[model samples]
Target chain A: MAIIEVNGISKSFGSTQAVRNVSFDVSRGRIFGLLGPNGAGKTTAIRIINHIIIPDSGSVTINGIEAGPLTQRMIGYMPEERGLYKKMKVGEQLIYLARLKGMDYEDAKKATKYWLDRFEAAGWYNKTVGELSKGMSQKVQFIATIAHDPDIYIFDEPFSGLDPINSEMLKEIVLELKDRDKTILFSTHRMEQVEQMCDDICLFNNGRAVLKGDLREIKRSFGKNTINLEFQGNAGFLDELENVRINNRSTNFAEIRVLNGESMQGILKTAMEHTEIYKFERIEPSLTEIFISTVGEDNINPKELG
Target chain B: MNLRQILLVAKREYLTKVRTKAFILATVLIPLGMIAFIGVGVAFAVWESDSEHRIGIVDETGRIFPRLQSVNEQRYVDVSAASPDSLRQMVVGEHIDGYVTLGEKNISSNANPEFVYGGSGGLGLQTSIRSDLREAIREERLQRAGVSEEVKNIYDSQIGLDTRKLTAEGEETEDDTGFLTIIGVVMGVIIFISLFGYGGLLTRSVIEEKTNRIIEVIASSVKPVELLLGKMAGVGALGITQLAIWILAFMGLSAAAAPVAGLLMQDQLADASRLSDQTDEAVSNFDPAVLEIPSIDPLLIVYFVIFFILGYLIYSSLFAAIGAAVDSETDTQQFMAPIMVPIMIAYFIMLRAMESPDGSIAVIGSLIPFFSPIVMITRIAISEVPFWQIGTSLVLMTATFAGTIWLSAKIYSVGILSYGKSAGFRELLKWIRER
Candidate 1:
């Protein structure tokens, strides 16, 4: 069942349309990724889902109920613009935020401690957030966001400031939450993270969703029967294939892009005829390549709808 | 929001603030500082009173020297004889506080005698010496007239006049000192309640949310109004706690200081004792009526508590809203000035009420919700304010408080999450309209 469903959610800030007809859904237990470069309205859409902002049009439903304060409690949101009371102790801040989510004092404390321990941040319980390193503070904030054990979680750039080790730890935690059947939607510019972590993806560009689907499906659909070939004696491909483009060539390797209707076997035969092919394999598109092609190199510029 | 949730928010605000080292310091230091300041002030008053002034006695005819000696022994003045040049030299040398250089003419001549000192002469010393000289000259002239010493004493002695007033109920009363003392206490209480009670809450609440940034989190969770009121109530409870502590502390300090203050007041009371004794034998024999001043009125206490809470809620809500609206402590300066203006204006009107409780300005200001908290207390202290007026003012103040909370909450709802942008009147107005 879809835990969160957004339809045609549009918002504008003054003359700028921050989000236009933005729509997405998060089914139970899914890790949904909202992917975009900066200023692509992902943050605006997340805000609209979290009810931090009112959309200029459209509606959202949480757990089949219209959005309101009760639904707000069901969702845990970590905003992109990092906000934490710098002078407050990590434990105190977490418990306070937990209580706001309707946890009793003891339950809030228990949950706070549990999350703090899980994040290896129990040592930072008494330390003011201001004194913590950026990575440590991010860990504390991550704990705060999920401490209430909400059914739905929205994290915007949750891994932005973390070191590699901490980022891995966060990914594991996010996966753990997903395993527990918590619907999660997170926005990030890092497509590689989405490729590794997200089950479903929605890519936004210039205030609109440019590409979106199950991560595997989106990557699969972008594949053009391409073959990456590594060979020793290839001077040129002799322009022999009916429909093939040499996307890139190196000293001993060539990436051949075949037309949609062509087969990879044809490309492999062509490569074999042209040079001593050392390695030839059909390739699926990487999320990075697909994201670049769909969103365009300059994601900030508005795209003409085709 | 429910009361429990509001209190949850408030509790967070209060605990975060009160546990802060700065809040603890302010709470403890302010009262101690006030007591120390008053102690220093009293000590200075006593030291100034005790220091004897040196007066140069010219005594051109040598007739006033005996009187000067007798009066100087009373410890008010130290007298010395000097040549005119020596007197000027002594004044310049700072050997004396000041000197009264009597000329050959009667000391009470048209030209007021000049008192000289190293810098500016002390006015108290000059007045004391001049009065003593005049008394001495009068006695000498009276003796020269050949009146018997006993008769002259009778003629020189002052006849005291007793004063009495009847209230509207026809009860007799002593001089208006009792009323004036009540006025003083009222003014003190007004200042105490406004500054420490209400304004202190404002400062502490600002510091708390600033520390916790629960403000930011809550700004996202609930409307700014809920967060702000919750903060105000939470810190207001802390303020009330601190107020209770202070009231007890003050009672303790005053109880401790009273005997000492009494001892210091003994001289003035003794002088009064002497004058009272010289009246009719029955009057003199009677025990000094223990001043029979009315105690603080229970109704006034009730009014004080009610108005304090309401007034505090009004201003504190505004303060919290302002705190959320601004980004930093320095930015608060621009906003705080406007908030403080009403408080200050209320205080000045309270002062005016003290001088003339029934005056047009005092009455009008007291009827206004903003000024009523302080001014109504002043009125209740001195004269009997009509119950209907108190009721009307309270109703008006409560209504105003509710309206202010609603408006501030509108601003707070929008303003708390808003950062980097300096929220202006237009933005606040926009928020209100959005609401």
Candidate 2:
């Protein structure tokens, strides 16, 4: 059963429609990725799900209940902007936040201690948050968010400020939480991370979801018919072949697009006559290529994509 | 939202503030400095007391010299013998403050003593010397006029008048109590103003936290109202603690300084007593009760505490609301000006009440909740205020406080999370309308 269902959710900031008819669902114990470039309404949708904001013309359900205070208790949200009291001690801050999520003092203390130790940040528990590095503070924030052990977790760019080693550790922790039957929704521009961790992906552009499905299915649907033939000698063999276009030709390789009627055997026989082929294979499209194609390259300005 | 959570937040705030070096210095050093200041003031007063003029006399006429010496040997001046040139040089060097050169003549036409002063003699010293000389000359003239000493004394006696006042309830008290009442009113005003002013500081501190985004994390585990109440309670506790410490320190310093003050006062009283002995007919006759210190009413102190807390809470909630509504401290100045205007007006009204406790302005201002906390205390100090007025003012103030809390809470809930823009009056109106 779907743990969270967002149907036709729409929200606008002033006259600009930030999220228009955005819809998606997360099943129990699965990792859902909301992928988009900057200002793509991913944060807006996440905010609506967290109930920090209300959708203008749609409904959201969590564990069969409509969004409200009780539903809020079941979700752990880490917002894009960092929110932590810089002057407060790390352990005290974490426990206080945990207690806010409905833990008693004793339970909050134990959980805070455990999480701090697990993150190898036990020594920093007594230090003020301002004294810690950005990555260290981020780790403390992560602990505070998850200390309540909510049923669902929403992380907005949780890995943005993390170092490679810490980011890997956080990814492992997120996967472990998913394994424990906790549904998670994470929004990011890192396509490679999504490919590795997300079971289902939703791609958004201009406040609308343009592509979404199982990761494997979406990749499969893009197909694998294009081929690259690297040849030592290929001056003018492409003119003799029927229904084949040499997309590009270099000194030792030619990228060919074969028409539907053209056979692979015919292409191979033609290539054999022309030159000794160093490499010949069909290529699957990368996520970067698929995102660029589906979302359209016009809006995908390189500077804003990151 | 629970009481415990509110207390936890309050405790954190209070502890953080108390542990800071600023709080420690303010709490400890201010009272000590006040004592040192008072000590310096008293020392100056004492030094001024001794430096007043002392006149030396060198009289060739025995009759005039004896009389002049008797008059000059009082508290303000000392009389002794010296030649005219020696006296002049002593006056110039300030060895003698001033001197008199007596002419050799008794009831003669051309024989008046010459007086001289050292440097720029002040008005007080000049006045003293002139009065003494005039009195001596007048007596000599009276003796020459064939009036006997008894008749002269009788003609020169001063008559004293006593006063009594009747209250609205037909009760009579001495008019001297009016001055005592004024002192009491002044004390009450001091307490009332200090509490309200410092309590506003507490509220502003809370608002600073919200504006700085520190309150978001705090409120995540606590309710907004709890946070508000806890801060008020915590800061109130700190204020009370600081006040108690100040009062205790003041009392201790006063007790330690009282002996020296008493010694100086005793010396002044003794000099007055000696002068009174010499001029028994000159001193005015009045009842000792007119000069007695008035006793403090415990009930008045109790009323001060009650009004202080109520007034502080009322103003503080407004301050806190203003703090939350604005995004930054600089934006708060515009709102603060309007809020403080009423408080300033109220304080001045209270001052006016000190002069005329039963004036129309005082009566109306005391009845208004905004000014009642201050003006009522002044009225209670000077004259007997009707119990019903106090009751009515309390009820009105309580109602106003309740209303303020509800309204501020509405603004607080919306404003606490808002950022980026300066929340203007129009936006506030919109927030209220939306709520």
Candidate 3:
């Protein structure tokens, strides 16, 4: 079921068109990702869905209800530029936000306690946000977003400022939310995070969704001609490869995309000669390649496409 | 339109502010400051009056000197035995405040006596000495002219005018316009402080939220109008709380001191009754109530609160919008002038209203919404304000407040989310016009 259906919504700030003719659907019990580079209208689209910024045209519906304050209450939104009142105590701030989302005082307090304890931040309840470390406040903000237990959750760049440990913790919680059949939507340019989490995605380029669909199907549709090579040697031989394009290359790993009519086995053979291959496999193009190819292609030929 | 959300937001705003040190300081300090100001003035006056001056009279004409009595806290002593040089030395040595030499010409109409002194005496001391000398010279001249003491007493006596105010109902009451003006001035100052102090606080709070980037999170949960109103309600409630504390303190102080004031009134009345017994029995029929301080009309206080709330709502809404338009407190400077101009103008008009509450300017200003809160409250306190004018002013104020909130909410809704760009006048206008 389409829990959120955005129909060709457009928004502008002054003369800058922040979002243009953007349309997408987020399904129930699924993790949706809005993948785009900075200033590519991903944040703007998320805000529009949250009804923080009304679209200049078209409409958005959540569970058949038009996107507004009513629909807003059903969603837990952690904005890209998220923060808590620096002088407010962690517990009170969370409860305040929960109450604003329609929770009564008792319920808000209970939920706040549960979430703070879950994040292992029960001691931070009495501490002001200003006194908390950056990671600590980020966790508080996360708790504030979900304390009301909204059915649909929207997180914009939720992993941006987090350290690796907290990032993993956030991922685990998000996956746990998904396991409970909550519709989750998050926007990020970090492809690995999207790859590990999102079941569906809409790739945005210059305020337009250039590609969108089920993650597995989208990856499959790109074909399995790419070679994922992991080795232990200087990657200097990657520059000599013909009939292939190196999507990414590092000391021990390179994802080389095989051009049409090129064999992946031939590329693997070439790589094995220069370096010892611990692991090499033929696979479909990563989301990062598809993102770069789609958004990068649009960037290269701006006038023709824009 | 969610009442619960607005209440929740307002509750948070109120609690956060009320718990702050600044709020507690302001609430307690302002009344203490006013009391200190009045206490200082009274103490200075009492000290001035209590100061004593000692004078040495170098009288060449002994007849004129002996007739002079000690007056105006100045004491006279004979210094004729001392030489002119010694008298000067005495003054320099601080033996006396000053030495005044009276010659035979001092008794004449164009008398100019020489007074030698250190620079310690003020103009008040000199004026007192001159008046005392003139009185003695006049008495000497009158004695030489053979004028009787009875005639002199008649010549010195003066009459006083009794002031009364005739009401619209043709009843005369003791005039207390002076007291009323004091009330107006005090209330005007209170309103001024509350408007700017609380209004600025609201603006800074908005800027804080924007700077901290918490506004977007809150914005997603509530409508901008609701947020703005909740803040206004919260801050407004806080302001009222402070005002209530001050008013209660004043009332309590007055209640505690009323008996003492009444006792002082009775003392004055006793003096008047004694005078009346020596004069005519009809003079004793004077009403003692006329001498009593006029009590404040509770209705005026009610009007004050109403006007204050209306005024605060109107100004704070604009303050909130200004807060939203700018990213920081420093960026608010460009917008402050426009908002401040009206308040300043109203304050000036209120000053004029105190002098002549029924003047054409006062009447007009009191009816204009921007000026009415301060000006009309002053006018109402000073004299009888027509019910229609008060009714019209209240209506206009409410309507203006409603319109201001609507326009301000529009600017606020768009401005809070916008970042990086410091909003100019043109940008704010665009935001107000944006859908």
Candidate 4:
């Protein structure tokens, strides 16, 4: 069952149309990614879903109820710009945020304590946010978002400020919530995280959703014409390839997309003449390639469409 | 829309602000600072009044010299016997405070007496000396004109005006109009300061939430109207708490001051008798009622609180809206200028109300919502304000603030989420119009 159904929401600020006919849905017990570049209306769409902004057109329903204060309580949103009261203590700030979401004081405190312990940051409960390191405060902000234990969680650019280890930990927690049958929605430009974690996604380019649906199905529809090549030598012959679009190329690796009527074997032979190939495999296009191709095709048209 | 959400926000705002060291310091220091300021002023007045000046008079007009000596025997010395150089040396050596040399031309139609001093005293000292000389010269001129002692005594008698105020109840009482005017201005000033001081605090808190980026998180959970209302309630309560402390402190100090004021009055009477050389008459004739402290009407305090809340609400909502429109404190100056004008006008009108409580300016000022909180309170303190004016002012203020809050909420809801660009008046208007 779809927990969140955003139907054709449109929003504008003055002459600038921020989101136009953007529509998507997230099913229960799933990780949904809103993949987009910067300034691509992802934040605006998320805000509409959270009921922080009233869309110029369309409606959002959460569990058969229209999005509003009632549905707002069902969601936990961590915005791209994370903030806590700099002078407020970690525990008090979290509890305050939880209480704002309709949690009782005792429950909020208990939840705060549980989350602090879960993050192994119990010692930082009394410390003010200003006194914490960037990574530490980011953890506190994450805790604040989840401490209320809402059924739906939304994170925007959640891993931007986290170190690799912390990012891994955050990913694990997000997946853990998914295992518990909680619906999660997050927006980011990073495709690898989306590819690894998302069961569904809506790719945004210029405030329009160009591609969306089940992540696996979307990837499968892109076909197996793309090849992942790993080699050791001069990769100079990649320049001589025709009818193939080279993407994400490094000194020892390349992802190649063969257009229609292009021979994958001919490209592999040319790569072999220039370097020794250690690995070669036919694969469906990555989210990165799909995003580039989709957005690239979108850029070809006039951008300011009504 | 949610009372619990508003209360939650209010609670956090109240606790966080009250916990800060700045709040504690401001609460305690302001009353202490005022007391210190008043104490210094009283001490200076007492010291200035008690001290007497010694003058060396070189009366080349021999007719006036003896008169000057007879008027105040201890203050004047006949330095006419000394040479000019010796007199200059005496003045330089501090033998005398300075000298007054009167020539024959000085006692004529327009006397230009040369009264030089070593600059040891303030303008008060100079004024006293000049008046004394004028009196002596007048007496000398009168004696020379063959006027009798009885007529001269009649000329010397000073007439005083005894003022009394008729109360609304039709009883005449000791006039305390001047005293009450001071009280009224003080009350107005307190309200003005609280409105500005606490209003700025509300604005700063809004800017903090917006700039620190916590506004989105909070706004998502609660409506912007709830957040603004909550902040105002929390910060307003804090202001009232601080004011309560100050009022209590004022009451305590005044209670302790009764005995101290009595002692000071006694000292003043003693000094007066010594200076006038009429010991029995000065002390016997001194009426304590002349210096009596009038009782304040408790109803005025009730009015004060009503006006204070009304004024605070009106200004704080505007302040909060300004905070939302700007990204930083530095950007607030542009918006602050417009809001500051009415507050300044109200303060100036309060001063005018002190002088003529029933003046047209006072009457109109008290009726306007922006000025009424200050101007009306001042008029109420100084004179009997009619029931209808008070009622009208209260009604207008309450109605005006309701409208202000509604308008502010519209602007606040959109302004909080907008980032990067500084807001202009056009932008603010658009936000207010955004649905």
Highest DockQ scorer: 4
Residue-level lDDT tens digits of model 3 in B294-314: 788899999999999999988
Q: How accurate is candidate 3 locally (lDDT)?
A: 0.87
Which ten residues in a row are the worst by lDDT in model 4 chain B? B286-295
Residue A230 of model 3, lDDT score = 93
In candidate 3, stretches whose alpha carbon ends up further than 4 angstroms from where it belongs are A122-127, A231-234, A240-244, A260-279, A298-306, B41-160, B260-293
Off by over 4 Å in 4: A297-306, B40-60, B64-136, B259-293
Tens digit per residue, CA lDDT, model 1, A1-306:
789899999987657898999787788999999987777889878877777677879988999887766777898888766668887788888988888878888999999999888777788889998898878877887787888989998888877767898788778888889889888899888766667888999988878988877888877787656677788775566356666556455778766666657777766776677778777777876565566566555654322210
Q: Report the candidate with higher lDDT, 3 versus 4.
A: 4
Docking quality class, candidate 3: medium
For residues A140-214, could you state the per-residue lDDT of candidate 2 as single tens digits?
878977998899998887777778877887788889999899999999977756677889889988899888878
* Fnat, 2 decimals, each candidate: 0.38, 0.11, 0.89, 0.84
RMSD of each: 6.5, 9.4, 5.7, 4.8
Clashing residue pairs in candidate 3 are none
Instruction: Give the Å error, residue A29, model 4.
Output: 1.6
Best model per TM-score:
4
Backbone clashes in candidate 2 total 0
Task: Please give, for residues B1-435, the per-residue lDDT of candidate 1 as tens digits.
Answer: 656668777887778777888777877997788679889999999988787656565555666667777767643243444666877777678665556555546643444556566655356766677777677777766766778879887967999877776766989975564565365445435444554355545654554454444444554465445566677877777777776677678667656665666554565556676788654444445443343333454665666677778778778777766766766656667777787787888878877777788889988898899878777777767776788889899999999999888888776666656666557666667777762
| Candidate 4 local lDDT, B1-435, one digit each (tens) | 889999998999999999899999998888788879999999999987777778899988788778888888888999988887888888798898889888877777675687777888778778878888899888877887898999899889999988998877989988888888888999999999988899999999999998789999998899999999999999999998998888887777776677677678779888887788767576777665544456778998898888889999999999999999999999999999998999999999898888999999999999999999999999999899999999999999999999999999998999899876569999988888889
